[model samples]
Target: MILAVGNIKGGVGKTTLAVNLTIALAQQGRDILLVDGDEQRTATTFTELRTEQLGQAGYTAVSLHGAAIRTQVMQLSPKYSDIVIDSGGRDTGSLRAALTVAETLLIPVQPRSFDIWAVDQVAELVKEAREINEGLRAFVILNGADAQGRDNEESAEALSEIEGLEFLPVSIGRRKAFPNAAATGRAVTEQTPKDSKAVEELAALLSAIQ
Candidate 1:
């Protein structure tokens, strides 16, 4: 399965979610390929850090830059059971092309007005991608929200207002562990194995996608 994790706005945890989900899926013994489509290469850097921290021989991160994105993604489909594509913040020709071949498009959004606006554009892009790829499945997920308190009302309302959208029941809360884990090039599950909100949320998100 090819899962494209993306959004129109940056800093809404697209790459974070991508990396963590890929790691979690890999832990489940699935052969995974994490493609860093972002020019910033945040996901690539995280993979490098993970290699060093774990004393692996080489970096596990991969990149599919420039043209030939569709070809690359298609080639990966048979080799790996799960391929997670972490795209850039803004929409791009290359991104649209990749999404066209993706099995599932996971859109991550934060709780804010600007982020909310980006959701519409991202959804439209997903719809366009679906037009080209009939089997493409798109889903919205709330990230960086306070699940324990009422601080997540705006995001919840926005999610509710958007009818006919598949919103994941799992919402990733804003926590220090996420940033700390990203800094060291490790997923939250590897950083904190027990009683971690990031781990639990990611696991739930993966289940929903499955």
Candidate 2:
């Protein structure tokens, strides 16, 4: 399956989810490809760090932008077990290009007023995307929510009002482990000592998507 972690909303943890989700999926022993569809190349940078620090990152990580991005992904999809796309934090052509080939789109939003408002725009895109790609599914995932606050609940409440996307019950809290894992070129679940909460959260998310 091809999964895309995307949103038009920047600073909402889209790249974070994209990179980590790729790592988590790869840890499942699946042959995964991480495609950096974003011009910023955040996912590509992560894999670079993985190569430098961890030595020989297991899977392929490449940047695929431009109008032909969708065509490229379609051609490459059959060669991997799963292809995960990470697009820029906006409604750019590359993002739209990614949507054309993605099976499911996961929109990760932070638990705040700004983030809550952003989901509406993407839901509209998803609704439109599904018109042409009937098998496409969209899910609203809560990311970086305060570990102890009503903001998470309130955000989920706001997400519930969205028409096209399904609200995912699973969420990833605002944990230092995310940045820490990124710094070390590993998933939070792959961190040394292993953060139990982070592991459990990611596990739930992977299960939800599957």
Candidate 3:
């Protein structure tokens, strides 16, 4: 499967989710390929940090931008069990290109009204993508959610109204473990004294994807 983690809005944790999810999938013994389709090259940097700082290369990572992602991924998908594309945040060439070939797309939104409003463009793009790629499946996940607040619930409720996108039940809350682990190129699950909530949240999201 080719999975692209993206959103129309930036700083909504697209690269973070892509990096962590790729590592988690690799740790599960799947042959995963991490593709940096974003011109920012955030995913490539994370893999580099993992190798340099932690001496652990989570998986094979390649940087391919713009329309290149569409062709390269289609060619490479047959070789790996899964390909995770970190397409940055925007309605760019690569973002549109990814939708052409990706089997699944995961869009993460913060629990805020602005975040909820930003999905309109992405939802439209998904509808267009599905016309050409009938197998394309897209989902929305509420990330950076408040652990014990109603904002997350409210966001999930709003997500239900979006057409052509399914909502993932699990929500990833604001946790220090995410940034702390990313600094050293680690997934929350790989942290020594794991944040139980972070682990739980990631596990649920992973289960839904698999």
Q: List the residue pairs that clash in candidate 3.
A: none
- Candidate ranking (lDDT, best to worst): 3, 2, 1
lDDT score of residue 47 within candidate 3: 91
Local distance difference test, candidate 2: 0.84
Judging by TM-score against the true structure, name the best candidate: 3
**Clash count in backbone of candidate 3:** 0
Highest-lDDT candidate: 3
Model 2 per-residue lDDT tens digits across residues 1-210: 899888998888888888878888888898888888888887888899989988877788889885667888889998999998887776468777777788989889988888788778888777777777888888888998787978889889889889978999899888888899888888887798788888799889988997
What does candidate 1's lDDT look like per residue over 66-115, in tens digits? 45567888876788878888877775765787788788888888877788
Q: Residue 86 of model 3: what lDDT?
A: 90
Off by over 4 Å in 3: none
Each prediction's TM-score versus the true structure:
0.91, 0.96, 0.97
**Per-residue C-alpha lDDT of model 3 across residues 1-210, encoded as one tens digit per residue:** 789998978889999999889988999888999999877888888899899987878588999988889899989998998999998776468888899999899999999999999888899989988889888889999999986878988999999789999998888999999999999889999998899999999989988987
TM-score-wise, the better of 1 and 3 is: 3
